[model samples]
Target: MKKIFVLDTNVLLHDPQAIFAFDDNEVIIPAVVLEEIDSKKRLADELGRNARSVSRLLDKMRGEGQLHEGIPLPKGGVLKVELNHKSFIRLQEMFGDVTNDNRILAVALNYRLEQEDLAASGTVTAAREVILVSKDVLVRIKADVLGVQAQDYLSDRIIMSSDIYSGYVTLFVHPAVIDEFYTYRYLAVEALQLPVQLNPNEFVILRDEMGSSKSALLRVSMDGGKLEPLYLSNDAVWGITARNAQQRMALELLLNDDIPLVTLNGKAGTGKTLLALAAGLMKVEDEHKYKKLLIARPVVPMGKDIGYLPGEKDEKLRPWMQPIYDNLEFLFDTKKSGDIDKILMGLGSIQVEALTYIRGRSIPGQFIIIDEAQNLTKHEVKTIVSRVGEGSKIVLMGDPEQIDHPYLDSISNGLTHIVERFKGESISGHMTLEKGERSKLAQLAADLL
Candidate 1:
């Protein structure tokens, strides 16, 4: 049976296109929701952008028919602007205030009783299902108390975090194929005899299944034309060698000039930021492929509030960008406490900026590294990528488990979103570093604590 979905304000803010998601179901927007959206429309964040889009969509739709009476939706559903159910009946007594949430609840309750009355009077066959969709957890709980069916708005959410693309696979191929791969230095992708088609640039560990101790680490060619050996080098990248297979895979993409976009995923202490920085320095300073090296990370509020930050841009960013500086110090091998500052001052082409300030600029001829990228939203990531100039490489690295953004999770953050969407593209590559190389204590803390 068709259902009536009462959308909360947050649902529209989370995704402006959410109204069209419910197929063949009537979508009723409470007048309070529009009021809330209107209040948020003047803000500066992504929520404000979504609020504007929602308004534009509604205004465009209003031209078709009267939204209050109900309008035809594309997928055999009705979109209605519910204006009359503003005051609460018993909900006002229970909640003590007719707040926006309670007012929305009143609308749903009013619909339920009206539909039930019509069904009881034989005006309709049966009462239609009424569901309140919201992204707020507390609202859903309150809805349950008020005897309303509520669910999370999850059309944009990725289902499983554990099932995210790891960008590599292990295969136990026949011993002869391994030997041929070694001799020829490349093998046909068709000879993998795999269950499914491998993504371009995906790494594979081919172990000899004949009970022999022989193996080779190969990567799927960019065109899926062949399986080729990795550019595994014993040479250290700014004093850090590839400690494991995943790191080597990460470096292969990092150092490769062909792949312009790369994403690295791992837990803390896995060297995601360090490795990307090392490669960025190599390409920009050593190889001279890019004119400058630009590093930026989202300024997440953790130790103190951003408003409480006291200083000019550089001084204020000292705390958040310290982690990046620490990695740089490690790469530059700065022994003294203030030596990193000297090194940074000497590099005329290096830029350490915040993601907030990096927007609206055409960044080209630079190697850009975005650290802690999991804290970003999809629209934020899209904006960042669009700012990349004609000849630059962008690396997005983060630990999915350590996300600080409240609305994001392991699978829904911008880092994982880019990994999933860019896997098949030739210019993109990904690596998930499992091992923590920071220290034994840090690894233990990450695992157990």
Candidate 2:
């Protein structure tokens, strides 16, 4: 049956192309949603950009037919800008104020009654299902209270968090396979006789199936043809060494020049930012592989502009970029105040940037790190990653479980989305660090609190 979907303002803000997502279904945009989108179209953030995009899309569709009556969507759905259902009589007693959310609810509730009335009168065969689509949890709950079927706009959401790829897997093999891996220092992928296919640059732990302790740690070749030994040296990066197996895997991906894109997922205190910075510094300063080290993070929840802060651009970015400064100071072993800043000024090879300015710029031959990446949306991440030019490496690291974006969750955030989407590509690699090496107290707090 063809269902009628009433879209909330947030759904359009979260994704401008959400109108075409419901296949062959009648999608109704509440007039209040348009008002909200119009209100946001003047800002200079991701929300404002999305609001403008939605306005353009709606205007283009208006040329085909009057939006109030209805129009055929290119992707097999009918879209209509609902204007007659603004009456708040159905919700006046339950929700006194004629707020925007209440007005949206009234539109959906009126649609439901109209559908039922037509069905009861035999004007139509049966009532079409009316579903309210929104990204807000409280809005969905309130929709349920008003007896409207509601669901999240999930077109951009990736898989569940539990099934997300962890970059490494353990394979139980015969004792001979482990011995061969050790003797040759590399093994053919066919020798494993695996049941499932491994992704490019995926780490593997070969354990003896004969109940022996013999094992070998290796990684799949970028072409997935061979299991090669890790090329990592015993030397520490920026005075930091991997304390756990997953951290070691993260370094392997981080240090490899062939893999231009790396993603790290971990809980707080798992050393995600530290490892990324160490590898970036080693590549930019020591190896001279990249021209500079550029770091960025979202001044999150959109519209929290660094422009509102005092001083120059660098001074404005200091607060949001303090975590990066701490990591850099530790790497440089700075004991005096303002020493790291002087070192950065003297080095002239490192740049700390805001995520706001990263858009619409081509970044090439730089070791780029995006901290707190989980706070970004998929579109924002796409814009950032697509800006990478020739001879550059971009590392996106963050704690997916600790996202603060109002419209994004663990699976839907830009960090996790890119991790899953790029896991199969040869140019990209991912690692999920499980152990926290910051300190005993910090680890305990992360687990307990």
Candidate 3:
């Protein structure tokens, strides 16, 4: 039973290649959707990039056949534009206005009605079922009220926007066990001794029965952290280096070229982004493991909006990227702000870009960092990830608990979605950092909050 998918303008704006994502299913792009895309084509951001890509894709399909009627897609699907006037009439009667979103909804509702009529006939049709797919939650709810089957486009990534792991934990181990490990340097365990919910790369602070002189560290190997790795280096991102046991494990995971996708989730002020940036810089800039260090992050406003600042693009981006700059300054030990700016200028090979311009371009052979990923929608995150070309490593870092998007909660953010989706994947890995190394005040606030 092949279904007819009526795509909303937001879906296309969220992902330009969304038409091809529904394999073998008939995709209907309402005329209103095209109009909306055209309207957004002039914006200089992700939305504009998607709009332009959609235009180029449709233009290329025009050479094959008529899009108004129907065209065969290379991926074995039918692409067509819905130009029915009845949809407008029905929309005007029901909603009283031809707003872009409502018009798109009308197109979907009209198609659904047509599908029912065709279903009554004895002849089977290619589109017996109609599915209105959009990223807007309210739109989907409205479609349900109109007696139409509507769904959110979720083909890009897995994991709900919430339920992402935070890297800190207080583990309860026996007093004798804690004392034994502190004295022996390694704890020999035969079975799973810790909590079942512990994720890889998570830090655990073991407390005695009396809760005193406990150790804080990372769990290097599976099976209750018994199999700790030998540490080779103490030089780490922050002043606090990964303990001998944690250092070896970090190096193993960081240097593995086979594992291209890595995620680090922690509270604000934790060394999640700094550690990832440090590891990336070390690998790409110091070790030459990658060709370039390409850093990007969502331009989400933290706290009150700064409005628009005056300057060139880079200068404008500097305010939003101040956190990134802080990390760079700390890593390079630039005592003065002017010296840090000079270093950033001198490091021509390192590209710090905004996530807005990543669409439609394929990036390969680079270490990409997507900071503050929790702000991105699942569709937006997919658009960024799909642009990864061959031989590229992508890392997503964010604090899921500190999401700022009005539509997205902790369960619907991109960071949580990526973590949940890639959990079982062998080539991908994730860690939740618990210790807030930024400062005592920051850590206290995170804990209290």
| Among all candidates shown, the one with the greatest lDDT | 2
Tell me the tens digit of each residue's lDDT in model 3 across 1-449: 77789999887876678898888889999898888899979876556777899999899989988899899877788999988757668667776876887877888888887777776773555437788998788888878877778987777644444444443356677787766765766654455365545544444556665757765444434333463433335565434366334333444455567768887777887677677777788878778888888888877732223347887778878877888888888888889867877886787757888776666799999999989998887767788888988999998888878887754566667778777876645566676666677789999999997
Off by over 4 Å in 2: 302-304
Runs of candidate 3 exceeding 4 Å displacement:
73-77, 117-127, 158-238, 241-262, 269-308, 311-315, 324-370, 375-396, 400-429, 434-449
Per-model tally of clashing residue pairs? 0, 0, 12
Q: Give the per-residue lDDT digits (tens) of candidate 2, residues 370-410.
A: 99999998888899999999999999989888988888888
lDDT score of residue 8 within candidate 1: 91
**Candidate 1's TM-score:** 0.93
- Scored by lDDT, model 3 comes in at 0.73
- Pairs in clash, predicted candidate 2: none
Which candidate comes out best when scored by TM-score?
A: 2
lDDT measured at residue 109 in model 2 versus the true structure, 0 to 100: 88
Ranking by TM-score: 2, 1, 3
Q: lDDT per residue, candidate 1, 1-449, as tens digits?
A: 99999999988987899889999999999999999999989876777788999999999999999999998888999999998663386887788876899889888888887888999999999999889998777888988888889998878876476679898998887899889988999998876668767899999898888879899999998998789988757578878898988988999999999999999999899989889998888888888999999999988732123556788878888888999999888898888999988888888878898887887789888899999899988888999999999899999999888987756778778888889889989999999999999999999999998
Against the true structure, what is each candidate's TM-score?
Answer: 0.93, 0.95, 0.62
